[model samples]
Every structure is written in C-alpha cells, then in structure tokens.
Target: MIETVIVVLHLLVAIGLVGLVLMQQGKGAETGASFGSGASGTVFGSQGSGTFLSRLTAILATIFFLTSLGLAYYASHKASAVQEAGLPDPMLQIEQAAPEAPVSEDVPVIEEDFTPASAGEDVPAAPE
Candidate 1:
C-alpha cells in the first residue's frame, strides 16, 4: 500500500515537473516578446517576486521530497513482508539431486634422500 502510493506520487511529480518546465519560457526568452514588458522593473521586485512557473516548481519539488521520504520510510519497515503470504518454505518443495563425490587423477611421486649419514661415512672413521 505504501509503495503504491509513493510510486504514484513519484510518477505524478515526474510528469508534472516536465509539463511545468515546458510551459515556462527559457531563461534567454525575450520578456517583451509576449508581454511587451521588455524586462522593465516590476512593483513586486526587480524581476518580479516570483513567476508562476517558479512557484509551481517549488511546490512540485516539495511534493517530490515528500514522496521520496514516504518511499524510504516504507522500505525501512518492509522486512515483515513475506514473498508469499500464507505459504511455508515454498523453495523446499523443489527436489534436488544429491551432489556427487569428486574424482582425482593419479600422479607419480619422486623422493629425495635428505639424511646426513652418507656425509660422515666418507671420512672412513677418523677415530674408529
């Protein structure tokens, strides 16, 4: 339920943001082209207190933040949800064959004489 609501809100914001942006003129647009104001100083402020698109953008941005928070909150608490409701260990239902023992190839072995008995034998009993 929570996820659905968040997704809906997210989608709505995405669409609305696009539409709102398209409806507003670009920054370089001529002020006098449409309203003939020619960038004149306004009573509201230098550039006007705020244009409709700017205000709408602010509102949509706030909604986007709220929906994002809602989604995060919902995700954090979703551990209690089960993949399948009222089902017990559905994965155990499938039967799997037993694993086979691995076989190894035979290899020849080489041995080396490391003892020191032959070393002193060559001395021929210095004090026998």
Candidate 2:
C-alpha cells in the first residue's frame, strides 16, 4: 500500500512536471533581429520569473527532482532487506496431516523394482 501511494505520487509529479515545462513560454516570445536584442537583458531577471506560472513550474520541478532522488534511495536501501514474494513453503503447509509410521517389516514396496526412464530414452506409449 505504501509503495502504491509512492508510485501514484511519483506519477502525479511526473505529469505535473511535464505540464509545467510545456506551458512555460520560451525565451523568445517573438523573433527579433538575429543579433542579441535588448530584450535578452531582462530574460533571466526578477521580471521573467515573477510570473505565477514560472513560480509554479519551478516548484513542481523541485518536487519532481525530490521524488526522483527519494525513489532511487528507497530502491537502493529500503528494498534491499525485503523478503522474497511467493507462496508459502510446501513442507510447512497446514492443510495436510502427517503420515503414519510403516505397519509391517515384510511388506514389499510395489515400485521397488521399477527404474525411472532416462531423459532422452523415454518415448511415451500412446493409449491402447
């Protein structure tokens, strides 16, 4: 459940990050002369980033980075000691009861004389 929550959070952060990046206006809203324009001076200043969308984009990007680092750390450290996920061992199964002891010393084992076929030697016989 915790892993599910973390995965959901990671997905939301990724979507938000992509949306924020796509919604941001590029450095040049319009193409002026090829040479460096005066407008370039104000691009990185407080004026450009003061916009609400820019602020939100920055915040969401930070969250995306934080979650990415956190997930990496969790995968490396927290998951190392986790147990193998599988069905319970058959020897410890509780549904069946223990077997009884052998009843007679002279009882012949029915399959004692039979030998198992070799891997490549056996071609199964079809039905009669």
Candidate 3:
C-alpha cells in the first residue's frame, strides 16, 4: 500500500518537473530576435523566475531520487525474501521443463539420372 502511494507520488513529481522545465525559457531566449516582444514584465518578476523555478526543480529532483532509491531497496528486499523461502525462480524452472527437439533420420530423398536412352536410334513420333 505504501509502495503504491510512493510510486504515484513519484510519477506526479516527474510530470510536474517536466512541465516546469518546459515552461522556463532557455538562456538564448532572452535575445530580442527570439521572442520579438522581449521577455520583460513577466509573472515571476524580472529575474525571479529562474531562481524560483530552478529551486523548485531541485526539490522535485531530490524527491525523485529518494523515491527511486526506496523502490530499488524494496525490490531487492522482496527478492531476497523470495530466495529465503526456497521457491525456485520461475525463469529457471521454465528453462528446465522445456523438452529437447528429437532428431529425424527417416526421410526419403530423390535423385535425377540424366543419361540419354538409345543414342544411335531415331525416336518415333507419338500420335496426336
């Protein structure tokens, strides 16, 4: 239950991070030729957008890292628990259960003989 919540939270954070990063303008966007109307008078103030968005992004990134680590730890712990129960790995059991292919040696082969029959005699024409 807790793992599910963590996974959902991680996904939301990842989506929000992508949106925030996309909304922020690149450094090259400040040039007059890019926006055509200039970048002055924005919602986040003159220079505040970069500082605020960058900080928020950093926080989200940290959370993402933590959740990732937690997921890895949980997965490894579960795998070890499974091993301790003495249950054979499904993949190994599948490989062992598969039967080997049987060899076949009874097939008949045909060969063509190309020698001409009665080489010195004239052949008779068949009636139509």
Candidate 2 structure quality by residue, lDDT tens digits, 1-82: 6666767888998898788778776767545525555544665553454377778877887887877777787777544544
After TM-score superposition, the amount by which residue 59's alpha carbon in candidate 2 deviates from its true location, in angstroms, is 0.9
Among residues 3 or more apart in sequence or in different chains, the pairs in candidate 2 whose N, CA or C atoms overlap within 3 Å are none
Clashes within 3 Å, all models in order: 0, 0, 0
Tell me model 2's lDDT, rounded to 2 decimals: 0.69
Instruction: Tell me the whole-model lDDT of each prediction, alpha carbons only.
Output: 0.71, 0.69, 0.83
How displaced is residue 78 in candidate 2, in Å? 4.5
Q: Pick the candidate with the highest TM-score.
A: 3
Candidate 3 residue pairs in clash (backbone atoms < 3 Å): none
- Order of candidates by TM-score, top first? 3, 1, 2
Give all TM-scores, in the order shown.
Answer: 0.48, 0.44, 0.72
CA RMSD, predictions in order: 13.8, 13.2, 6.2
Error of 2 at 19 (Å): 1.1
Clashing pairs in 1: none
lDDT for 22 (candidate 3): 93
lDDT: worst 10-residue window of model 3: 32-41
Candidate no. 3 TM-score = 0.72
Error of 3 at 77 (Å): 0.3
